[model samples]
Target: METDMTKGKPMEIIIRFAIPMFIGNLFQQFYNVVDTIIVGRFVGKEALAAVGSSFAIMTFVTSILIGLSMGASALFSQFFGAKQYEELKKAISTSFIFIFIVSLVLTTITSLFMHQIIHGFQMPMETREYAADYLRFIFAGLIFTGVYNAFSFLLRAVGDSKSPLYFLILSAIINIVLDLVFTVMLNMEVTGVALATFIAQGISAVSCAVYTIKRMNFIKFKRKVILFDKKMFKTVASYSILTAVQQSASSFGMMMVQGLVNTFGATVMAAFATASKIDSFANIPMQDFGNAFSTYVAQNKGAGNIERIREGMRGVSKIIVAFSLGISILVFIFAPQLILIFVKKEAVDVIAVSVYYLRIVCVTYTLLGFLQMFYGFYRGLGEVNVSIILTFVSQVTRVLLAYGLAMTPLGFAGICLAIPIGWFLSDALGVIMYKKIMVEDSV
Candidate 1:
């Protein structure tokens, strides 16, 4: 069901939308948690480390897909709220065709150069072959991932978050079932989980498309409307291109960090991997909430509800403060227990390093959450270049700090510290840009 977010109380609508999205994203993230646990315990640390390395590389490719989908989402939400039926329908098809082509091209390129791409990151020898094999299988489903995400974001843009949750739940179930069968039962290792994820992507993509065609008549395209509209193409391209570059740069920066972590040996690599996933899992709720907040702003922007958007931002700030502080405390306290879940009891060094990363970094979730909220705020306002600038500045700082400090005595701890610093810097810049935008709008 399409929701008219422009009509509801700002926080109320956002929370309602975010609840389902948070759950869906949580389950989607569970795919990785399950893979890490299964591969880490059943396979070995080497396989766990390899999966981690491969994850960074895979994320870089998928980030482009996500960036484009986010762009389409802003456009979709805007057009829907404004009641521009024709423009909305045209954009739906335009963005879909554009994303499909990009996905296909990426899949082809990544598949052909999978080995070279993985090696380019300078992964450790112990895990290079493992990473390559995992990536080779995982890249097989790029198109499905691209298609699923494009539609999922589209569905959410128009306030249909519940449907994606349902489809993703089904997909997550398939992935988990296959994870056990291939990794545990058949002993396929990291490759098994990769294939499982790939199959699940296919299922989700197929299910989302089938559901959209049958149920989402609002976004359904007619033959005439399917052709590209010059205005619509320009609008979407303005949003997608820079956002795609920023998103990919952010991942590339992480890949750079992974390369740095890899130099410290597989213990650090595995620890970094374990800590990264746990951190990401802990933070997914606020992140999803940020996305939900963006949709609310976008819809209101379309409706020209400036006061409502302001109301939403203020409400979210309170939530960010309360939620970030609460999550940080929990992650900090449970850091050791969380690491233990992924590592054997005897791997003392891995446990220590992973726990160290978690505690130090978890303290910065307040800044991180605010940064995400700002990113969503600007994205909703159609000021994507602000987002690009904030992201690039932060990522560049992270990469530079990761290398510079890693050379000093801090080592892996230096890499751990780089993250929060980056978030804090980005959030500062976000505050500045937001104030400037508000001032200009007043003028």
Candidate 2:
């Protein structure tokens, strides 16, 4: 369908597009958070910590696939906007092949190194075993996750965000139900949680792919269409590498932070994991808006409509700022209740530490809001390298800050403080880069 997202008023367009994405993204996080709550309440804190510890490693593997999908979305949106139907079809086909190969290789590599990678994080022995079990199962499911995500990206690129959202909601419900059955009834512990998640994601990915292939006429491929197009593959590969680097840098940095959290012991690790789920939920609005803006800007840019792109940016900025402030207030006020959702009264200190992190980081949400949008903005303009550079700068600095601070008088709180500081710096750099390259080029 790939309708022009830039035609309507920027705010209205963004809201329309973002609402579905927000719901979908929230549901996506719900699967994990709900699993944590169920596990913490039913299984135990160590189990929760184990599942949480594997998060960064899982994210590291998944980021490459996500980056590839984003590249496909960006490329498809541009081609769709230009009304190059045949080229768009070819892009879609090439993307599938590219994702399959990359995901297969990544899955194998991560699976083989799973134990070593968890060990490298230097987590407690109790937590490390659980984390290793979880990672092994999750790594097995990476290919399905990658394929599903690629299709989701393909759908979103063509202005059908609603479909992917529908599938995600279904998958979240499945994951929650399965989590209860596996963990509570079967007493499968962390492995149960991981298996439930993998099954849910697999089902969702299959459902989405089937629906897309059957219903979306544009993506239906002929023999020639299915054949990989060299030019389109090259274009996607070039842009995708930049995105891959950006994501790799970010994930690698988080892995570093995870290492620091591991040093603080299992309780701190569990708390960090719980807090991260809440943080992910809170940032949904801004994150979804950034995604919408990326597609919006890409479509408009392809049409050479600079004014529409600018207007979209302005509208997104206002919405993100308002949303950020609202979330900050809510998080500060409900800190205890939010923390209690995944932690317990005995672990109240862990909750307190998490609340401190969230409260402080809340101040920088608006900055992060703008920063994410600008990253999407440049990506839409096919200026992926700029985004990569900014991500590297920000993530590298965040790691350094967290590592150095955690060793000092500030301790865990110092590590928590690193987030807002990173956001501030990243936003400033993103704005500068956008102006220097994209804005200047437009003028």
Candidate 3:
């Protein structure tokens, strides 16, 4: 399944490549969606708010781990595309070793400060204990989370997207079954949901590691040949740290927005939580396309196929526009029904707030889609610093606007407006940067 994207028609190649990733991302969303639905329905709005509140914190950690893995994947794709097998092998071993060490350190730090972090967010006093308990177990399982992401991303880099998709499907199914048993049957509440995730992710991580070792030739980590190379480590780190910062920066901004919403009490928090999960789902096509396009770009860039990269970019934009428009229409029209999926009919305040938030954000999915694709293109070209700058600008705009607008007459609605405003600003800058790069390449 290792595809040579440099040879085919760019549009055909990208669409073919992107489809597997898009499906995989949908399955991947089961991690959050299952937990939200079960917890919201069985455990009540307070429990839902608890899990939702912890999302920003967990996202902050997941982003760093995922960013590092993405950096390593891009490196692998570049080398693989260039047909540099020896160096690629060494890079793989080094990246896995480095990420392992970082994961442990991050887990320890996050676990130790769990209380302070939740308190700092000014979470509702009633839900603080539930949120704290959920986060502790999640932090305990950070290794499984980090390892699975690393393995999955490495596989995708080699064009074996199907393998990871299969594994993710298996893991998601396991998680959902466990969610039903723990939250509904046994009434374990937040604790049960967290434990279910930990077990499912652990299984997936072990399965992926075993498969990777047996199947991937370039990924086998023989100690003698795998000794750290200063140059290679720096190359990987340089790419990873920026992306890590970018992801964490965006998560941090969302954390700020979460804090603003928390001020309005548990009803608004529950509303934001439900809308955010739905929002995450709505953005899947955008994210998956960006991911697919990034891998495509990296491989083509490695092969020095500039024109093909541009071709793929154009092809991806059409898909983005179509998916964006289509999803926006559905979500906009069915916002209340979508909210009802997580909340009960009696929870009128939660439903109303969630619907209002979704309507405001879903309409702007097109802009967000554009932003993600451009970010992927930049990252694929190994212009990660540009990607980081774009994230910073977007996050900063969101934080400043969210805080500034939250106090105004618009209140919570202002906070929602800030989401797309950030997207528009970032997309504008991203488009400018992308065109500049293409123009320079032409010259």
Candidate 4:
């Protein structure tokens, strides 16, 4: 069902939207975690290292589409909130066309330059082979990823978060079953998991797009009007392209961090990969809530309820602090048990390093949460350049610190420490930027 977020109590409305979104995001992250676990346990630590390395590469490529769709979704919410039905339909059509073109470009580049991309990571030859195998099938499925996000984000923007979750749940189940069949029984190693993901996501993307177009008539259109709005095209492009750059810059920075982690060999690489996923998993609630907050703010902004947007931000921050603190305690206390889920018990070194990395970063999720909310707030308000600038600050700090600290005695420990520091630095900057923007708005 569609919701008008501009009406309800801000916190109540946000939690309702965020609950399903959080679950869906969890399942989405589950795709990668399941791959890591299956690859790590069945294949070996080297393969785990490879999967870890490939994450950065795939995130970089896929983020272009994800970011674009996200930006467009904000616009969707805004238009819907304002009851600009015609503009919403036209923008939807335009964004779908533009996202499709970008997906093709990414698929082409990733296909052609696959080896060079892996080589840049500086992993061992064995790990590179595994990374290459993993990335090949993943790249083949890039178009499906674009289709899925373009539609799912549209659904969320219109306040129908549950439908996307249903689609992800089914596809994620297929992905898990296929992961087992391909990697274990078929002995396909990294190739099996990648192929599983490729097939599973194709199912979700096609299904979601089909359902949304056929069933949701609000944004649907006659075939003739699709892609005809030149002005809306510029609006969609500004939001989508800037957000895409922000997302891509983030993944690109991680790619650099992956290269640095690779320098420490397979053990550290495997540990970082697994630990980072766990870190990502632990902190995903913040991202989901931030997204919900953005949607809330977007709707209110479109309704010209600036005061409600302010209230929504404050309410969302309280939720963030509560979620971040609780998750931090749990993750810190159970770091080893969590690490064991991904790798074998006999892989003592990998487990130890994973624990260390987690312990270092888990406590700082609050800082991460605030920074993420800042990104979402700006993006929702159509100030996507602010998001890009904030992300640039965060990513640059992370990449530079990882490399700089690598030469010191702290070594890999320094790399782990950089994660939270980057968040803190960005959060500080986010505060100042947000305050300035609010003051200007008041003026």
TM, every model: 0.98, 0.97, 0.97, 0.98
Better of 2 and 3 by lDDT: 3
lDDT of each: 0.86, 0.83, 0.86, 0.91
Residues 1-443, model 4: lDDT tens digits: 89899897899999999999999988999778999999999998889999998998888889889999999999999999999999999989999999999899989998999999888779888888888899999999999999999999999999988999999998999999999999999999999999999999999999999999886786657888776578888999888899999999998998899889998999999999999898888868999888998888888889998888888889988999999999999999999999999998999999999999999999888999998899889999988998998899999999999999989999999998888889898899888888888777651
What is the lDDT for 89 in model 2? 86
lDDT of 2 by residue, 163-264 (tens): 889999999999999888998899988788888999998999999999888877755566666867898888888767678778778888888898889888
Best by TM-score: 4
Q: Which pairs of residues clash in candidate 4, taking residues 3 or more apart in a chain or in different chains?
A: none
| Global fold similarity of model 3 (TM-score) | 0.97
- Model 2 earns a TM-score of 0.97
How many residue pairs clash per model?
0, 0, 0, 0
Worst 10 residues of 3 by lDDT: 217-226
